[model samples]
Target: MAYSADGTRLFSCGTSKDGESYIVEWNESEGAVKRTYQGFHKRSLGVVQFDTTKNRYLAAGDDFSIKFWDMDNVQLLTAIDGDGGLQASPRIRFNKEGSLLAVSGNENVIKVMANSDGLRLLHTFENVSSESSKPAINSLAAAAAATSAAADRSANVVSIQAMNGDARNMVDVKPVITEESNDKSKIWKLTEVSEPSQCRSLRLPENLRVAKISRLIFTNSGNAILALASNAIHLLWKWQRNERNATGKATASLPPQQWQPASGILMTNDAAENNPEEAVPCFALSKNDSYVMSASGGKISLFNMMTFKTMATFMPPPPAATFLAFHPQDNNIIAIGMDDSTIQIYNVRVDEVKSKLKGHSKRITGLAFSNVLNVLVSSGADAQLCVWNTDGWEKQRSKVLPLPQGRPNTAPSDTRVQFHQDQAHFLVVHETQLAIYETTKLECMKQWPVRESSAPITHATFSCDSQLVYASFMDATICVFSSANLRLRCRVNPSAYLPASLSNSNVHPLVIAAHPQEPNMFAVGLSDGGVHIFEPVESEGKWGVAPPAENGSANGAVATPSVGASASEQPQR
Candidate 1:
């Protein structure tokens, strides 16, 4: 159930015993039905969710069709097309901002539709390619020119679209600079990666027919894109946005598509014949970007960035830690909030639990720490926010932030964030308002109430410089606020505002982290196991593309092949 501002009404959408879907509104006080929107969807899956950005609920069913219901009055707004033909369950997801809805299933195509600004086609990818293509489209030509002189040279341009609807190229583009002499036109090179016989205009790989992409997350800086499948995660793909007219487009060459057997924070079992447990639920990169930590099936494991080896493992806890975060100062220090309403601080240096922190009255949902003050803050389902000063693991200080006089009829959705270096100012999102406070003074600074009558904030974070505060609601809008004055900065659609490769209807970011070194760089982790990194416009006053990491992954292996390997063995662009 969801609540309206002032907690006067509650909203919920569920399937009745007769297998019919409905949106029921109730009075917050007496639990009386205030209103009901019938015919939510046929054969519904009972997993409907609210998107605060759009201020509505997303209802889907086994039929593959998704209906968007307006929350202002709980009415069927629009029904987007789905991929499920008749018997398949619907797989509809709203992008972070509700701008695009991605639907995929038994069909070879993953359809993405731009719902706002007039419905339009965003992209379409083939499910599987029977044969790869020849010397892939290597580059993109400059934008079409208006004059004949420019058209003469720029006629060879081609745009590279991926099978999964990743709008950008799968690899980097190498730009070719030439003189303005002979009617110079920008000629793009499109290099196809898949083999010739299997190339299809819109299909992905046949391997994906049975392989489920459990996660597709972006890095904190928004430069790298990560995808997790049944066997392994395709990590660290870089995208270069060109501005100069003469710059050439180049993409990194990749090896042939095949499954490998390995298991790490980014690895999965590729052999479909072998039954595997569900993929890991949570994954996080360290502040130093040196390791990837993941929690699954009650196990917490850390993998090395360079070797992808299991660096360490903590004591097995009772429940899985769905949310994990690395310490700001020490990569060895990790904070984990579990479904059990407890926070465990693990000391990687000794590979043991240094201390267990607890205070939340309900299950802990989010966790954050401040390096400047060496403190940890957590919020949870219990409707309470708690702060702890980390001295050693076993001994520390603790305090509970004040809350409203009484618990609202329902618990607020899980979302919280601590300010930048200054832990003094933090943001706690309640069902109706975003409360600002100074940790040191232990006083509420101000509250920004959502008068638009949207759902409560689901995800919130502060910029590296503490200049902006962003919060995402069930309405599908990310409301940005100014840290200096607590004023509304702006509301942005994650799909419209986020990097192209990271945009997807099924991708909903649950965690946001700022880059420790770069002021404007940040990374977000999604429920689909996707991570995206975004950088401000003027990083270092120069738009420098992120160089690929020299790890032993596919790209890294090609960059530094083993001895006795012929130079021709290197991946070709």
Candidate 2:
């Protein structure tokens, strides 16, 4: 069941008592049936959804076919046969704009269709099963059963239930039956019976099992799609838009939009067994888009983005590598945060670790490098922040920040520390609060409570113009804040990009990487292992507003310094 966009009407579908399936529309305010459409599906109804966009249509999927109806007149528009086998209860969802629909069921296929023009078949994604060994095991079991039956005596067959039920009520005597001998005068007694049990055993493969998409959603822009399976999330970018006909209507001849898989997150049971609380795999693209750094299993893989080839691999000692960052101006220099509360500085060109900075007593959680200030900052589980002078490759300062009271002391709650694109300011996010600091002063300028819940902040970044700060939380929201006064700007609920039902499911943003050049464009990495590049539609006068005076204090303002300042100068207190 679903409510219409205006909340004036309601739509629902189900099988009737007489075995007939139907879709009914109801007036929400009056609680009266507005219209009833019946006899559209031969079998039981699977799913029903109302298009909320200008294309006011209703879609219903059943065992064998999907039917489209015009919501205004209650007329059948068209019906498409299911390409795969029976889909008794297929999961269906519409994109945010109601332009496309996705359908999936027990089969290894997901069908994408156009909703505007007669429900045309757009694309079919097949062989998306999570467990590859299931098919082979089924075939092997069938073959084993076929061969095992041939060795059993047909006449000696007896139902186990019949024997067990009646034998307990009978006397302890064996009944005898006679078979005629060749002479006809003599007879042979046959009283013995034999039963053979069939034994079949199968050994499951030890490798990682493939998972099918159990849930799917589109970003609000409809430019990205996310597929969530068992322990992995697959992310794809819509490479093209649907073409329109001469009359400005979407046509069937237009080929399906191309989708490119950007990245995937795979968290297997084994990886979880090792730590039970393993962090999700994360990737970060360099400022120039030349190198891509990915962290998995305590190893960092460096890849050339243009060629998509592995350039080098760096393995940290003891604990796993959790976070990574590249120097804004020099891609060759990479900073890695390790599980053992140490930061390793590596020169990718030389393929060697240049230095290790240790200050925190717990695992390192965040790392960031500022090209303008030539400084590196790191945070760890011990609630301590360590600042390093990149010029001399030495630790400059260490500060122990107060941790939130009554929280467990297992892992570091700090998630990020990032420099603004303009190099004027930096942000340190710990627990639910974000602290903004000036580069020259290195003092906390403004502290804002970023989230209402205790969910830790996962990622934070400044817009390319350095006027706004974007922070993502574990509660599946990206909060936008004004850089000057740290005032709340807006909250972006990514789930709003999905269908109403699926939006309620648990999906959190894990990693966020800003685009090098575009201020409004950035890539968001989800907990399911999906990386989506978001280019939101701009509204009028929405960008770069000055912070409110009531929220900004006099001490929070810092003057920008000239580029020629000496590195040996002490930072202003």
- Backbone clashes, each candidate: 77, 2
Best candidate per lDDT, number? 2
Residues 171-240, model 1: lDDT tens digits: 1112222233111112211111122121111111233332334333444333334444434443444344
Q: List lDDT for all candidates, in order.
A: 0.45, 0.50
Candidate 2 regions exceeding 4 Å error are: 1-280, 405-411, 450-456, 493-495, 528-547, 551-573
Residue pairs with backbone overlap in model 2 = 130-210, 130-211
Determine which window of 10 residues in candidate 2 has minimal summed lDDT.
Answer: 193-202
**lDDT (tens digit, per residue) of candidate 2 on 1-573:** 454544345566644434466778866434356898744656454333333333366666665655666677576755555434436655566665554456554445554433223121111111222233455443433332332342243432211111112211100111112222122222211111111111111111112232322223333222233333334222233334323432221111222232332453332111223552454344455532244576544456665533445576667435667667776446678788877778888788888888988788887777777654568888876877778888676888777764455556665565567776444567877765677776655677777653234456766777655666766666665655667666554445544443355446666666564433245555455554433444443332232233324422242432221111011111212
The TM-scores, one per candidate, come to 0.45, 0.48
Best by TM-score: 2
